[model samples]
Target chain A: MKIRVLVSLKPGVLDPQGRAVHHALEGLGFKGVDDVRIGRTVELDVADETSDEALTEMCEKLLANTVIENYKIEKLG
Target chain B: MAFRSAVITFPGSNCDRDMAVALEQVSGTAPLRVWHGDAELPEGLDFIALPGGFSYGDYLRSGAMAANSPIMREVIRAADRGVPVLGVCNGFQVLTEARLLPGALMRNASQHFICRTVGLKVENAQSLFTQGYDAGQKIQIPVAHHDGNYFADEETLDRLEGDGRVAFRYTENCNGSRRDIAGVLNKSGNVLGMMPHPERAVDAAHGGTDGIALFEGAMKALASA
Candidate 1:
C-alpha cells in the first residue's frame, strides 16, 4: 500500500517562506493573488496491513510537529 | 564528586567542541564527547549539552532528524531523571522536536538567516542555567540561525509565563518568536532550550564573557546539589 502525507503550518501560525514567495509574485506583476501558504508532502509505501491508526501515529510522532503543524494522510491505491 | 558532563555531537554539529570547552572551563573537567549514534550515555552524568549546527543537514525540518536519532532516547531518559540538559540554537530545535521542550522554531520573520550579537533579558534566574545572573538583568549573547522563530499556542505561552518557565527573552525581538521568547526551561526546570549561543559568548576573546555565567551557574548548581 502507498500513502501520501501533507504537512502544513496551522492557519494562525506565521509562514515566513510562504509570505516571501507571495511578495516575489507581486514583484513580478502577478495580481489578484491574495495569499500563499507552503506545505510539504511525504509519500510512503507500507505493508498492506498498515492500519489508519498506525499511520496517524506516524504523523503525530514524527511526520508532523503537532506544536506548529498539521498533517493529513491520503491513501493512494 | 566532580562535575560529570557530556556533550553529544550529531554528524553536522559544529559547536560541540565549543560547548565542551565552555563546560571544561567552568567545571574544570572535560566533558565526554558522545556521538549521536551512541545508544547509551556514560553513567553518572550531571550535565548534558546539545550543541548548535545544521544537524542532519537541517533536512526534512530543522532538528527533526537528529531528534529521533538513537542517542536521543538516552538523552530523554536522562532529562526525565532530572539531569540538567542545555540545548542551544539547532539544539533547541532538537529539544522541541524531541518534546523535551514546548514550541517549534520556524523561519525567521524576515526570512533571512540572522547572525549577530543580541541583547537578552534573563527572564527566570531560578533555573540551574540562569541562577548565576541577576534576575531581570540584560546581557549580550550571540544568535545565529535561520529557524529560531519560536512558536507556541497562546495558552501554552501564558502557562509558561505563569509557571515561570520562560528562561530568557530577546531584548530587541531579533526573531519573530511568540512573546519574544529566546529561551525556555522545561516544566521541571532541568532542561533549557535557547536560541542564543551562550557558548559563543563565554570567552572575552570571543568579544564578551557574558555567557560565562551560564556555565558557572551549572557548575555551582551541581556542586551544591
Candidate 2:
C-alpha cells in the first residue's frame, strides 16, 4: 500500500513563506489575493496490513510536529 | 565526583567547541564529544549540551531534521530518565521539534536574522539552571538567530508562567515570543532550551562572563545532587 502525508501549519500560526508568495503575486499585477498558505506532501509505501491507527501514530510522532503543524494521511491502492 | 558532560555535534554545528570549552572551564573536565549519527550518549552523563548552529542546513525548518536524527533518540531518552540537557540556539529548535520541551520557534516577526548582545531577565531562579541569578535580575547574553520567535497559545503561556516553567525573559523583546520568553525550562526542570548563546559568554576575555554563572549554577546544583 502507498500513502500520502500532507503537512500544514496549524491555523493562526504565521506562515512567512506563504506571505512572501502572496506579496509576489500582488507585485506581479495580480489583485484580490486574500491569503496564501503552503504545505508539504510526503509519500510512503508500506505493507497491506498497515493499520490506519499506526499510520496516524507515525505522523503524530515524527512526520508532523503537533505543536504547530497538522497532518492528514491519504491512502491509495 | 567528576562531571561527565557530553557535547553532541551535528553537521553545521558551529558552537559545539564553545560549549565544550565552557563545560571544561567550569567543570574542570572536557566534555565528551559525540557525533550526530551516534546511537548512544556516553553512559552516566551528568550533563548534555546541544550547541547552536544551522543543523541539517536549517532545511525544512531550523532543527527540524536533526530532531529526527539517530542521536536525538538517545538525547530524548536521556532527558526522559531525568538527565540534564541544555539546548541553545539551533539546539533549542531541535528540542522543541523533538518534543523534549514545549512550544516552537517561529521566524522572527521581522523575518530578519538578529545578532547582538541582548538583555534578559532571569524568571525562574529556583531551577537547577538559574540558581546563580536572582529572580527578576537582568543579564546580557549574545543572540544570533532569525527563527527565535517563540510561539504558544495563551493558555499554554499562562500554564508555563503559573508553573514557573519560564526560565528567562527578553528584557528588550528582541523576538516576538509570547510573554517575551527568552528561555524555558521543561516541566521537570531537567531540560532547558533557549536561543541566547551563554556558552560564548562564559569567559571574561570574551567581553562578558555573565554566562558563567548559568553553567556554574547547573554544575553546582548537579554536583550537590
Candidate 3:
C-alpha cells in the first residue's frame, strides 16, 4: 500500500516561509491572494497489511511534529 | 573529583569539539564523545551536552532526526534520572523534538539566518545551569541559527513562567520568540534547551567569557551534591 502524508503548520503558528512567499507573490503583481501557508508532503510505500494505527503512529512519532504541525494520512491505493 | 560529562555528536554536528573543550576547560576533564548511533551512554555521567550544528543536515526539521537517534533515547533516560542535560542552538531544537523540553523552534520572524552576539537576561538563576549568574543579570552569548524563534502555547508559557522554568530571555527579541525566551528548563530543572551558544562565548580570545560561569556553576552544584 502507498500512503501520502500531508504535514502542515497548525493554525496560529507563524510560518515565516509562507509569509515570504506571500510577499513575493504580491511583489510580482499577483492580486487577490489573501495568504499563503507552506506545508510538506511525505509519500510512503508500505506492506499491504499496514494498519491505520501504524500510519498514525508514524506521523506522531517522526513524520510530523505534533507540537506545531498537523498531519493527514491518505491512502494512495 | 573530576567532572564526568559526555558530548553527543550527530553526523552533521559541528560544535561538538567546542562543547567538549568548554566542558574540559571548566571541569578540568575532557568529556566523552558519544555518537548518534550509540545506544548506551557511559555510566555515572555528571553532565550531557548536545552541541550546536546542522545535525542530520537539518533534515526533516532542525534537530528532528537527531532527536530520534539511538543516543537520544539514552539521553532522555538520563534526564529522567535527574542528570543534567544542556542543549545549545541546534541542541535546543533537538531537545524540543525529543519532548525533553516544551515548544518548537520556528523560522526566525525575519526569515533570515541570524548569526551574532546577543544579550541575554538570566531569567532563573536557581537552575543548575544558570546558577552562576545573578537574576536579571545581562550577559552576552552568541546565537547562530535559522530557526531559533521559540514557540509554545500561551498556557504552557504561563506555566513555565509560574514555575520559574524559563532560564534565559533575549534582551532584544531578535528572533521574535514568544516572550523573548532564549532558554528554558524542563519541569525538573535538570534539562536546559537554549538557542544561544554559551559554549562559543567561553573564551576570552573568543571575545567573551560570559559562558564560562554556566559550566562552572553546573560543576559546582554537581560537585557539592
Best candidate per lDDT, number? 3
- Write out the backbone clash pairs for model 2: none
Per-residue lDDT tens digits for candidate 1, residues B49-161, read 99999999998889999999999999999999999999999999999999999999999999999999999999998888999999999999999999999999999999999
Enumerate residue pairs that collide in model 1.
none
> DockQ of all candidates, in order?
0.89, 0.47, 0.85
lDDT of each: 0.95, 0.92, 0.96
Model 1 CA deviation exceeding 4 Å by range: none
Please give the RMSD to the true structure for each candidate, in Å.
Answer: 0.7, 1.9, 0.6
lDDT of 2 by residue, A38-73 (tens): 888989999999999999998887788788898999
- For candidate 1, give the DockQ: 0.89
Please state what fraction of the native interface contacts candidate 3 reproduces: 0.68
The sequence of per-residue lDDT tens digits that candidate 2 reaches over residues B1-225 is 899999999999999999999999999999999999999889999999999999989987789889989999999999999999999999999999998888999888777799999999999999999999999999999999999999988888899999999999999898778889999989899999999999989877877988998999999999899
lDDT of 1 by residue, A1-77 (tens): 99999999899999999999999999999999999999999999999999999999999989999898999999996
Give the number of colliding residue pairs in candidate 2.
Answer: 0
